[model samples]
Target: MPSSLSIAAFAAPLIQLAAAHGYVSGVTVNGGSWVDGSNPNWYYQPEGTAPDTPGWKALNQDNGFVSPDAYDTNDIACHKSATPGETYITASAGDTLTLYWNTWPDTHHGPVLNYLAECSGECTAATADGLSFTKISEAGLLSGSNPGTWATDTLIANNFTADVIIPGSLAAGNYVLRHEIIALHSAASANGAQSYPQCLNIQVGGSGSTALPAGEPATDFYSSADPGILFSLYTAFTSYTIPGPDVWTA
Candidate 1:
């Protein structure tokens, strides 16, 4: 039998594990639901529910996955081994896309960022290391009146869902939208910030032929010592520095 101290130690990690988990369940493009597990044709097919199975995409399993202590590595891009050959969801360039998560912990307060990568050829064959992403949208701690933290931002706080508008002026083509959440509750410690990123295959439809601006690699997003990821959020603060490339406007 485990001793009282042993039991407490074992329970502590479980508590932490439960607090840090979450995943995007569905992507809504142009009013259609592309549920991850339900529609394998539009999204990567999760290898039945277990992360250890063959064809299981690493980041999709949010049981206890987190990333590098800093932006020194490319793992920040897609979390882990991403599912390839996913069918791209079709949408208009200006449409508003919604990303729905299973559930976000109320305590995990931080910014939400959305990115887009125009595929050079076929998105199904694209790999995380080969794709270049443009910051399309990012929301940080809100200011004014009552003031708002990213955790308390609009529908994201209440519904675990956030929306970003597709750039209307963007040229139509195949692309991947990456929606991410940075949980900073334990960020004061080294490697404490949890970055959850989900990439969705997409095909944009528009007559515009504007070229996307230059962007940075996911590995370039942060450093282990970056103040944003190593700072405390439990005190009085006015603003926040989102730890990625600037949002690109075409």
Candidate 2:
């Protein structure tokens, strides 16, 4: 599928795009339809007025991001001051989730990662605290030097959308999906990396028997000095090591 990106070769930068750092605008469950999965306006809604979906709300105002300086706080878990989703997405064990972002800047070269955490009960009641996440999907530095073609670049080429697969062998349960993109545009400096993570709840029901894999807390996922987190995209690099724990596949 990387061949789809060849169009980017003869037609990049010159597109004269009105770029902006973006957020999850919609999500498609099982490739069926699009829904406003992430309630972007949860902060401004009157009490109990937010849209009911698996997507949680955070303080990522104006498509803002959480800096590495706040990596130690819960803000790093989702976004700044995130709250749990009020509902859950009804999905099976092996479903494909399509995440659509509002926009992503071409200058923001970085990796894309997704993590999964199981919840004992309904995930709506689950918070970022005490949650452990195992990397499920990640891609970075797909090819070439000159900083390489990153996952974020692919997302931009695909109209700011990404697809993640749910482990087919996963056991029936409630879980939270943490999807993130680390923009390394200014990551050359310490604490200059911008982390934009969004969380959503999922109710998976199937006969598969694999249990949730062991995971690490989001706060412990990365350090400001990590090679991937504190990187300079301006340099030429053929390979990039995406930060966070090894991906868990069932």
Best of the candidates, lDDT: 2
Candidate 1 lDDT over residue span 68-88, tens digit each = 553555567766656543566
lDDT of 2 by residue, 154-181 (tens): 9988777899899999998989999999
Residue 139's lDDT within candidate 2 is 94
What lDDT is obtained when candidate 2 is compared to the true structure?
Answer: 0.80
What count of clashes does model 2 give? Answer: 0
RMSD of candidates 1 onward, in order? 8.5, 5.6
> Please, what is the whole-model Cα lDDT of each candidate in the order they appear?
0.65, 0.80
Best model per TM-score: 2
lDDT of 1 at 70: 36
Off by over 4 Å in 2: 1-19
TM-score of each: 0.79, 0.89
